[model samples]
Target: MSPHPAPDPLAARLRDVRVDFGTRTAVRDVDLDVPAASVTVVAGPNGAGKSTLLEVVAGTRPPTSGTRWAMAAVAFVPQRAAVPDRLPITVRDVVSVGAWGRRGPWRRLDPAARAAVDESMERMEVTDLARKPFFALSGGQRQRTLLAQGLACGADLLLLDEPTTGLDSDSGERIRAVVRAEAQRGAAVVCVSHDPEVLRIADSVVRLVDGRVVDGHLGAGATEPQPA
Candidate 1:
């Protein structure tokens, strides 16, 4: 007898998906598949509805039409993360919030969960600021904290919007490393970014224009070196 068929590698699939806001149609008739263990970069000009597409996939916003198939667990880090500067929360405290989906509200973090959080913080290079106030950290530092939080969620699919925006070179590389590592671990990662550093590591590129997917492909051309 033949061996069992391989499982579907996709983490999410969209068919004729559209997103509308009042009179504005942000995204229209889009079909895309997010492959597991790969990095897909969504790139486009302003008002191209990149974020809206991400929202649709993340299930934060229901599509006005079409169908979506997604994994049960998804971790998303939005671009316009308005983390209050005066919140009086520690970095570790903020990152721990990501584990709540598994730990629940009333429960505490187990040793495994704690270890995940710690590892995420260290990977994002925010371990030194673990006890520091979230508001006291710089903008870049705050962004890393959020990224670490998303990583700690331990979701099979991760959606990141402009994860490396406004970060220094070193910080940007750190973010890129973590993102690549996630993809290597079989997470379907979709990121919206214009940063060259981020794009350099993509296994596939989804180009959008006026809320439409103009093109999507794998190994299109030359790419930068991967993390050591």
Candidate 2:
């Protein structure tokens, strides 16, 4: 990995963001910068738009009206496991979804693609489950599969929503470690969770309250209005 600038990393910038669910505003004029290789954990009370913020940033849910820009490649792992129970695919196959962009239209798997899938499984420590049925795995194992999916994307921006939800302490810690490792690898990782453990791994914090950033970073003098 190249030595990137410490102060300003290639990042995803949201300018003048606003979103609403009917009359209920989920996000209002929220501006944020998600920098590369930095863990920015978002925490807040219920209905704070923790998940919505991540979704908008990932381009899954576009802001009702705003300029959201991602300067580098990005991917998302939703709170729910995306694998279908009856798909009959294997663990390795689950991770390979990340490479769909590089796979030409209707192209079959080649040696290089297979190798990439293998590496993603290895990184998640699920190589042993490579040929195993994806639905047959436990929740922890499925979460790891999702982790591998994001990693396999080889993107500089990764968005994870409540990754540790419903996970035991051990599995949650293991997942947190992977998120930290992602940041150390020059990828910006934003994890949305109410768990303090999630916030502990963040280099910076964005505290949201009722659909707005109430505070920036978890420190003194951070209550100023943030760019949206």
Candidate 3:
């Protein structure tokens, strides 16, 4: 494993972020910095508030206390994207939505946006499924489509939750490669994953327990890399 370069400007910064649902505290007093051109993995057991923390960083949920500074452009892929099986949408349609952020909701995808869409689908190895109905694809294929969508967005910040969960080893590796490529391209990639294979790609690892960050480390020995 190579050493991670000195971290660049932050994609997102959190200071004492706390998220609470009425009497239930989902996350508490958390502070974090997501740096560009690097992969950061958030890992922990269920109910550890890993997802909740990710949501805060993604700007989907407001924290009860503290400050969060996020980049102007952000893309997020939730653990389980609810793509209705009956929706009349093709793989291309799903990937095209990624460009909606850049082109605006009303504008048709121009040549540049179209090219990005095609490139992203190819990066995820889903170009062959371009015209296929999204619902007809297997779980792993659907996951790849969602990832391709995120990549197509061209956002500065990418947040993904358990992207490899339930995926076969090959499918998982494909996802990891794309994510690493995104980071190398200067996008800050934050992922919530438990799979050691997925975690191995992280330049930094943040471990949470009971809604608080128990360990956050960067570079070698921060996380013990697992064999491929």
Candidate 4:
């Protein structure tokens, strides 16, 4: 037999991935690659492992039996915006969540971290909401706030799961714009959505059925397509 192919450094690689949950298997023998310089959308029905895939990549969950190779400096934006800190926290405080990975347990913010968080909040358009309570924000505002948290991580790879889930059309549009801009700034964006419209702006689309990928080809779809 020929030698096995080498891992692609430009991509996040998972080979022979399997994740078992009690009596059932959530994902099995899943081999995938999410490449750099592209927005790859993972689409699947409910319980089909789309979110699980993201979670695994985010280091929130580990695969039961396989190697998961995530690119360095990965940012994760979960579906239900997480206020990892308590509610009532200010937007600025919430954005600071992104810095957790960059800080040591005993470390405090230095001038650099302060500058990073400031820049992230501004990019998410939450600088004005900095003093506002995170829980008091509207759904759209909350979404933006969470994105600010992800941005503050200052990672070059972002894993966003249904980033526009609860937003109104305008809010969703704004979120999409920010996501697109992040890629232009040299970040690799990976999004999981059943909404093909959300996948429209993606550089490629991968369809997952029952936790198995059906396609992983570059998209020929229209550029800058808007979600319905």
Task: Give the TM-score of each candidate.
Answer: 0.91, 0.86, 0.91, 0.85
Give the alpha-carbon lDDT of every model.
0.85, 0.79, 0.87, 0.77
Q: How many angstroms is residue 113 displaced in model 1 relative to the true structure, after the best TM-score fit?
A: 0.7
lDDT digits (tens) for residues 208-227 of candidate 1: 99999998766435243232
**Higher-lDDT candidate of 3 and 4:** 3
Lowest lDDT sum, 10 consecutive residues, model 1, at 219-228
- Please report the candidate that would top lDDT against the real structure: 3
Better model by TM-score: candidate 2 vs candidate 3: 3
RMSD of each: 5.5, 5.3, 6.1, 5.3
Ten residues in sequence with the least summed lDDT for candidate 3 = 219-228
Query: What is the Cα-based TM-score of model 4?
Result: 0.85
Residue-level lDDT of model 3, residues 6-102, one tens digit each, is 2447778888988999999999989888878889999999999999999998988988988888887899998776778689999999999999987
Give candidate 2's whole-model lDDT.
Answer: 0.79
